[model samples]
Target chain A: MLLASLQDVTFGYGDVPCLEKANIEVHSGELIAVTGPNGASKSTLLKLAMQLLHPWEGKVTLSPTNTAGNKLVVAYVPQQIAAFNSGFPSQVTEFVRSGLHTQSSNWLRRLTPQAKQAADEAMQSMGVWELRNRRIGELSGGQKQRICIARALAMSPDLFILDEPTTGMDKESRKSFYTLMREQIDRHGKTVLIVTHNLSEMNDMLDRMITLERREEGGWKCCTTTLCSGHFAPAESLH
Target chain B: MLHYDFMQRAFCAGGIIALIASALGVYLLLRRQALMADMLSHVSLAGVAAGAYLRINPSITGFIVAIIGAIAVEYVRKAYKTYSELSVAIIMVGGLSVSIILMTMNKTINKSFSSYLFGSVVAVNQLELTMMLAAALIGALFFFLLRKPLYIISFDEESARTSGIPVQWISVGFSIITGMIVAAAMPIVGVLLVSSLIILPAALSVRIAPSFTSAILVSMGIGLTGTFTGLTASYELSTPPGGTIAFILLLFLVSGLCVRKIILLASKSTSKKMRPEIAVKESRISKNGLSSNLQKIRQR
Candidate 1:
């Protein structure tokens, strides 16, 4: 259901454009992984897709409505979010429950029973329920990452954009995390565009992979591939 | 103190600013904009100087200029995303420089400006009290209605934006609110010491509170206590309200931090005596700022 697409996008931090003429598309119910080497601007692609970053010269479009014809709900987990703001004074439950703030109909009203259940189920699935009462600052890196993912999970968004969501998790935890994402896509019909370096771990779960490669002329471009057979195509050609 | 009309106004003004500004401090501190209140106050001073020179109402001009400064800072902060503090410094320099030049040109206000500089809380008139009340009401409503989104943005703005919160509008609104509070608070603590009311309470509260909501409550509690105590001490000692209030808040911060350290140390020693292995692991987690492994060990 063409959830989001960035076509011929050009963006950069400084004078020189780092990502030029990059393109990618996300459809509803598809689990996609965006992978590239260090400095390949993988996160930039996701940011562009989410409208967090404006493209210097290209069209970046997100569906205003989901397949259900309601406002499209998106949840993004930026890289190293927990580590960057480690000293933030919030209980794990409080932090996770805040994800449902956007879903609540009234700003001042209490969380509905369903919303509260979603928050609890998210924490339980992520294995952070026991640490619900603990301060977020007190958690380890892996624990922090899990709770952050749990926060996004609680949102029950139509689209999930995650950047390196499994940075510090153990092998078993990472596998379970992938399984949960797969369930979100298959059972709930959610769309996911994840930025990851652990391509091998998520390869099986992902329907497609987008790799950012540096051009000889000095900017980056997106190369899309179907995960199972590795059938490659230029990002612009895919759509 | 309560018998005198001016004293009554001063206490009322001080109490209101303490509550609103302290809650604001929690958000500002969490957003890493601790210096924003200080910068806005300095910028508002430039407006005061200009108003005196032009024979306009200084408080009105100062309030307008503070709001302008906040909006300017928000725009500049966006440009210097990686160096957000640099935007604060740039605006501060511009503000202070203008103020000094304006003050030099307006000698008639030199003697009278001490009230605005060092803060003559006892001199708070009806107009200033009304302005403080208005700002406090607006601030209280802003914090209460937007508490949920504000929490998410404070933790991670990018994520909050993707989650459908209007991050830019909220960010600018937050700045405007900050400016209004800073300007309104000027009469009580003056420009120089206004930030102490906004930053000090939250600084201590963030350290000790268990959750985000508790942190705000704790900050307000400290601010109210500090302001009341400072006002009493200043009245009794015949000292400057601005300096006295700032000093009291600083004392609260230092004492709060000291008590927290003492408790942590006591816990460490007791844990070491009872479970040496767990104590060592706890220290390791504290040292490195990671605790998942410890949680795993506890679960096992």
Candidate 2:
């Protein structure tokens, strides 16, 4: 059930390394959180996992589930950046519907019955089903954020990744979001890795916590803290 | 004759360009690169001027230069990621300035330039029509085939790539495709007004349509409707086809905006009137223990 791993991963921007010598393994059906301080390359690490960025000095490999023909499916919902291009003209349902576009081959097909059911259930779970007909641009910050979560849910991927999706959400909303994530992990057996700064709120829900911090010697190093204790061991030592 | 050969040819070329431009416009508008069509058109204009100066086929030169300019826009956007609109500005200015230089150097280029600027549908030669058809073919191929990738990319590029989409290649391919369309559309709407075809219809469609697909389809409808109407008006009035088409599109855009505003205003007034009553009703329902928090006002 080892889904993916980044071996000796080192990545940087313009020659200056931010994440270095990082090795991480993702097992199936685990809820994990990647926690770090500012400038700790947390987002960069997510990029590597999602294959958006390549390791300058290492390898990233995904283990093919025997049933999946060497393909490891992943769905990522990025951090809620305020500067996102809001010019997109999709209703909430339509936005979620687009998430399935990546998984299927047939382009521009009408929302199949399955896609529609998935979208409905996802929106219902995310508590945005009522907003299905509303334009995405007309929604508030938190409402739009929920729509992002709904999009990823609609994908129903084997490995789900989220980057600080609750940045602007209120306390009640954040709690519900985490509960929903927990349900996805426990009931549905979906593997999830989230990059978040809200460790105080997330520690209880996470099965494994990966800590990335600037090393004393040079580039950043990562450690894994298992269970709800919020402890850390260097990745090398853990292995 | 109700249908002259020239009229038939012009409409044939114009209709295809209209559909392509409208579809491409939705993607650009969604990406907030609404001015991309305009920038590429200007770039094509410079190429046309250069070709006319050299006494070569301007359509060929326009396509090549526009593609190059489109690629340059991608690079410039990456370089200035925080200010992506800067690329459009750079291309627009650079293209116009280059055209000015080309015009000054070859005085006879003025006549050719006017034809490009105003667009004489009657003068769309067999060769030009053939070129437009080729561009349309390429445009349609990319537009339909890449629709899914383009949708996900425009929705959230980072997320799209995270989901294993080939974002860079598709984006570059899209740029080239739009460039081809702009080059093809230049002779129909004129280089200066070509972006209007890409932008106005999309802007209008998004306002009225409920989904991205419908928005695109609506945009194409607007493009076709506007093109045929403008073509007829131009033929009757003996006006420039490019100007007539652009003017018609502007009317559509203005009307769409007005409709959206009126709808917004009307909804606001109605909601304002209903708010207090709804709150009272909600409180009464809540006391009976069957109601959700209608006490909390939803933020739009």
Candidate 3:
């Protein structure tokens, strides 16, 4: 099923168009990479897909049937991992447990056993379980990013969207992250969409690539691998 | 200590303020809008001054006017969404200007207004205590009911919207809660010191707790501790409780930082011992000529 679709979408910030005439479709268990230069509306497109921004033209729809009435379960990892001032006291486990916000109803009480187990599993999957009790401010950038991903995973969303998930990481860390993402896509059958500037670096892991570019005649052009390169291949054409 | 009726009222007021401030503080710290609380508190001062000029109960007038100010701030923020900070600055200036104008217009200066500006523990009466408890209970209930949506909004707004959480309403709800705390805290800590009662404990709490629950608990502990210590110290030294509470809160912030530093140092020392294993692994790879072999394969 087409999990999400953006047809002839145009988005703007108060009459200043950031994206124009863009179209895309994302299906289940696919790793789609959105790549473009700065100000090509990469982030804006992701926001539109996530329903954060309403498009000025065209329709962006999430199939409710695919979501199965679990609208609150869509996980997201933002580009910048938020920084708290020194002496921020939140533990890694606590941070991860926040992902379960959609699963339970009580706000004032503690997490349930199932919620606790999910949080633990998420931390373990992200390889940050050992640091669960440690303070978030004490973590390195890569470690913090992993914890953020773990937080998203704890939601157990069928669809996951990440904005620059591997930014500011070493090459080894990036490789490990892609491996984890691949495992989630393959093993868990989770649909993934990521917005990244470093397309050349991520080419090997992407199942398909979509580029948003400005046309000479006014308006934006969205070119996908199948339509632009005339290559209707799947993961094989990624490299 | 509890024999005096006034003291009992003061303690009750302080307890209510502690819980409300702690609850609001968690989000304020999370959103990094601690300064907004300060701005709102200062703005509410003008309302108190106006109440004093009219010879009306300042707490009631102050709360009504403060909610209006909070709504004004929200409207300004919505109007100039991109330049939200400018709205906060404008409100700060407008609030200060109003206070000065009201004070200058009234020839007979009210001592109560001055005491409120600096804060006075002796001013908390049973009526004020009852109001504080009611406000605290309502605030607690609202947060408890909307905790999930609030968490999502606090962490990331865009995702929360897509997840079906009403982002706009949540923002409004948060502002209302802020207004309530500002209102309830005024009678206990006074206008100028109210923001401190909300922010300091929450900031310190976030440093030690890993989860939101733990963070809230830590904030409550800090709030209660600060209030009790400040009250006792003020009574013993014949000093103002507001200043004492601020001083104690600052001390806790510094101590929390020191503890974090020590932990970091200890971790660094432990990681140093693990470095040799990494070095040994590298040496083994080099000895096996696997690195060069990979390089040769890549070159082809």
- What DockQ was computed for model 2? 0.55
**What does candidate 1's lDDT look like per residue over B1-300, in tens digits?**
789888888889999999999999999999999999999999999988889899998998999999999999999999899999999999999989998899889887888788877788889888888888999999999999899999999999999888888888889999999999999999888888999999999999999999999999999999999999999999999999889999999999999999999999999898779897887889987866656766777899
lDDT of each: 0.90, 0.82, 0.76
Candidate 2 runs further than 4 Å off:
A6-17, A20-23, A55-69, A81-87, A108-112, A214-239, B1-5, B89-105, B276-300
Tell me the interface RMSD of model 3, in angstroms: 3.3
TM-score ranking, best first: 1, 2, 3
Provide the lDDT at B26 for model 3. 89
| Model 3 per-residue lDDT tens digits across residues A25-111 | 988878888877777777888888877778889999876645454442577787765442234456788778877775445455678
TM-score of 2: 0.85
lDDT of 2 by residue, B95-211 (tens): 999999998999976877887886777678887888788888888888778888788898778888767788889889988888888888888888778888888999899878877
* Tens digits of lDDT, candidate 3, B55-170: 88777777767777777787888777777787788988898899889888885765557676777666776666766777788888878788767766766676666655677777
- Point to the candidate with the largest lDDT: 1
- Model 1 pairs in collision: A140-B291
TM-score of each: 0.92, 0.85, 0.83
Q: What's the DockQ for every one of the candidates?
A: 0.74, 0.55, 0.38
Error of 1 at A14 (Å): 1.6
State which candidate, 1 or 2, has the greater TM-score. Answer: 1
